[model samples]
Target: MLDLHNHTTRCKHATGTMSEYVDTALSQGVSVYGFACHAPMDYDTGFRMSFDELQDYFHDIETLQERYSGRCTIRKGLEVDYLPKHLDSRVLDADVDYLIGSVHFLDDWGFDNPQFISEYMRQDMSQCWQRYLHAIRDMAKSGLFQIVGHFDLLKIFNNPPDDSVHEAITQTLESIKSAGMALEINSAGLRKPIGEIYPSKQILRKAFALGIPITFGSDAHAVQQVGFGRESAQRLAKEVGYTKMLDFHNRSPIVCRIP
Candidate 1:
């Protein structure tokens, strides 16, 4: 199994060094080891790291990659929040092997009213969905990431949107396919209420119809979380006509057969 999305201590939300994660991957008998910590930016957000430490993040991972070069294939990668308004082009043009594009916020999703956040947290499942799919369309057009992370993350905190949302979801997926982008089947959502991958079965089926390649990621934030639900995620990919999981080398996808 392969894991493409994960975080380390470099990002405020996670803990541990590159080596610790690598050690866990080796022990688990993984064929590939990826270090996709959240990308450091010059922003002042609470979730992202400072760009000043970007070099440190790269340096530390570079050392671990060399140390484990013969034992395991270690790679340097990042999970970037791709808001075209806030993303600095220089950050994307860094030395990392590849990056995951995601939009955690649109102009910060900065709701001022406690009620907006609470209401967002409490919307009649359908209303909250209207807001999320709108956000997703904007994210897809932003053109900042090659792999879209958590195609339906709003479901993580709210209720699932219905068939009405499928039209917009399909349009976005088609655009992603036309642009030669891969959509990720994130296993991380299994811990949530739906207990299924983001985008669900219907969306996955639509993605296959649109001719998009599917990728799988644990979206792991800790060592033990690495490769979580990966076997099932692979099976889900196959159910939707994808026979291989996505691997990136020099920013281009290199498909690896799933067993």
Candidate 2:
């Protein structure tokens, strides 16, 4: 199985070494594991590692890649926030197996963060979803990423988006398809207040009908969290009629049959 979106201590908030995470993945029988630590950006300095730490991050992943060569496949990746003006080429052009583009902010406000969740009650919920999906559309159009991380993460706090945002979701998924990007079925949402997988069953059904390729990630932040909810994620994918899932090697998707 493949679990491609995980973080390390470099992300500031996540705990554990890269090796510890791999050990957990191995214990869970994951054949292909990846570390997509939060990419450094000037906007969120507190949560992500500084630009200078990029070297060490790469070195650590490379070390794990060699150390786990035969036992399990290790992929190097970066989870980049799709902030238009703040995105740097150093990260966009980083040499890694893949990049997971995500939208965690609407302007300066991190809509997903509980600290500013009250803002949701203040604004038009549909407008907020539209703005977030528009960012996803632009991120896909940029051709800078291989996977879309946590689609519908705006609902992390259980702030449901109204049907008014239907067209936006359709357009965003179309953009992802046009970009040849795969959507990650992130299980982390199950651990969050939303208590559902990323993209939701509704969105996943739409993506399936649109022929967008699928991938899986636990979005693990701690060692014990590695490969967490993997079985449920696989079950969800199958329920949505997905028989194969995408992994990556050198930023190119490698399709594997779901077992």
Candidate 3:
């Protein structure tokens, strides 16, 4: 099994040592486990690792990679927020196995943050969804990432998108396909208010139709959360007719069977 998204204490919001996370993945029979902690940005200093800490994070992962060299595959990555203006070149240009591009804000609004969720009540849901997908499109077009994190994170607060959101989703998926990026079926959403996996089944079916490959991420922020919803994620992938998932090694794709 492979799970490419996880966090470490440096991320400021996650708990546990990096070794604990890797050990947990090992206990869960995960053959390939990656750490894609939130990459630092000038805008969200409190929730992510700082630019100065980037090297330490890299060194920590490198240590784990060597420590568990023969037992398990430990890959390095960064979950970078797709903030065009605040994007840090250091984080973007860092040498990692893969970068998972994600969008957690719409302009100045951190739409998915629970502290700022009340803002959703004051705006049009359709427009909010549209803007979020457009941001995803732009992120995919940037050509800096290999994976898309939490494809439908905008629904974190349970605001399901209507049919009108389809066009934007299609456009975003097209951009992702054109960029040769894979969509991550993130399991973190199941632990959120939405009570489902990211990218909903409909979106997964659509992505399959477009010949888009996929990857799996637990988005684990804690020890127990490592490989938390992997079974469900795997089942969902099979249900959507996905027979293979992408793994990364030094930023290159390696296709593996879903089973």
Query: How well does candidate 3 score on lDDT at residue 183?
Result: 97
* Model 1 per-residue lDDT tens digits across residues 110-175: 332133366464346565566656666665666656688888776665456677777777777877
What stretches of model 2 exceed 4 Å from their correct place?
none
Deviation (Å) of 74 in candidate 2 = 0.5
| lDDT pick, better of 1 and 2 | 2
Per residue, candidate 2 scores C-alpha lDDT tens digits across 150-245 of 999988988766888888899999999999999999999989898988988999999999999999999999988888789999999999999999
Ranking by TM-score: 3, 2, 1
- Judged by lDDT against the true structure, how good is candidate 1? 0.72
Candidate 3 residue runs with Cα over 4 Å from true position: none
* Best lDDT among the predictions, by candidate number: 3
| Candidate ordering by lDDT (highest first) | 3, 2, 1
lDDT of 3: 0.93
Give candidate 1 regions above 4 Å deviation.
Answer: 42-44, 110-131
User: What is the C-alpha local distance difference test score of each model?
Assistant: 0.72, 0.92, 0.93
lDDT of 2 at 152: 91
Residue range with the least summed lDDT across 10 consecutive positions in model 2: 112-121
